[model samples]
Target: GIIFFGSQMITRDWIFNEFGCKFSITIDILCTVVSNFQVIVYTVAALSVERYIDAKLSLTLNNKFRTIITITCIVLIWTMGLLMPLP
Candidate 1:
């Protein structure tokens, strides 16, 4: 967005021709989708904890491997996010 906005402000138009235009558009869409998906991921995580609390069950995430699970989730989320914008 900053790149697009600044370029347009300086030249009053897209200076990068057709291919650059498509590349930039693809990048912009990917960033937007990834950020939106991150929000969804966090929301789901919160909901899972909430559901566990409501059920009066021991939190499954109390294990020593929780950090590994968290990292794996993040990596999968980003991988999906990156793939989602491709043709």
Candidate 2:
């Protein structure tokens, strides 16, 4: 996001050849998508860890179940992250 915004700001008063413009656009899209995916993954991981710690401290879930739940959450997180960027 920052990359794309900065590129736009920098190019506002400048002229780019066709190749340069295309390359800039491609980089912007790639950066945006990758950044979004990274943010989602980090957020999900933090939340998952917090939840797991809370459950562990409170003794609300057994170790095996907690492990299973954590794995499931991770899988879902990656799946959502991958699919959400398709649009």
Candidate 3:
């Protein structure tokens, strides 16, 4: 929903209509794409690795420790993506 607002603001013509600069839409598009890819791909990979570790340990996957691990994984995704080059 926040992205929807960003998309609208990105396309508005009034400022450019006055300033005579064309705003290409690719910036928003690339940001939208890379952000999703960054989050979803990393989260899924984390889940997969957690599942593997849980299976190897022969333990139920929904323990408090697992929850902590999942949150840490998501935080890692955000931190790592911050250091990565954005599209």
Question: Candidate 2, residues 39-84: lDDT per residue as tens digits?
Answer: 5776777697867787678566677886786688777766666555
How well does candidate 2 match the true structure, expressed as C-alpha RMSD?
8.8
Q: What TM-score would each prediction reach against the true structure?
A: 0.55, 0.51, 0.57
Query: Each candidate: what lDDT?
Result: 0.69, 0.68, 0.65
- lDDT for model 2, please: 0.68
lDDT of 1 by residue, 1-87 (tens): 557668989999878778877887787877788777865876588568656664784455464565566677677766765566445
TM-score for candidate 3, residues paired by index? 0.57
Q: Give residue 65's error in model 3 in angstroms.
A: 1.8
Model 3's lDDT to the true fold?
0.65
- 7: Cα error in model 1, Å: 1.1
* Candidate 3 lDDT by residue in tens digits, 7-84: 558985334332232333455556667777887788888878877897797555557777798788888998776545
What is candidate 3's CA lDDT for residue 50? 76
Using TM-score as the yardstick, the better of models 1 and 2 is 1
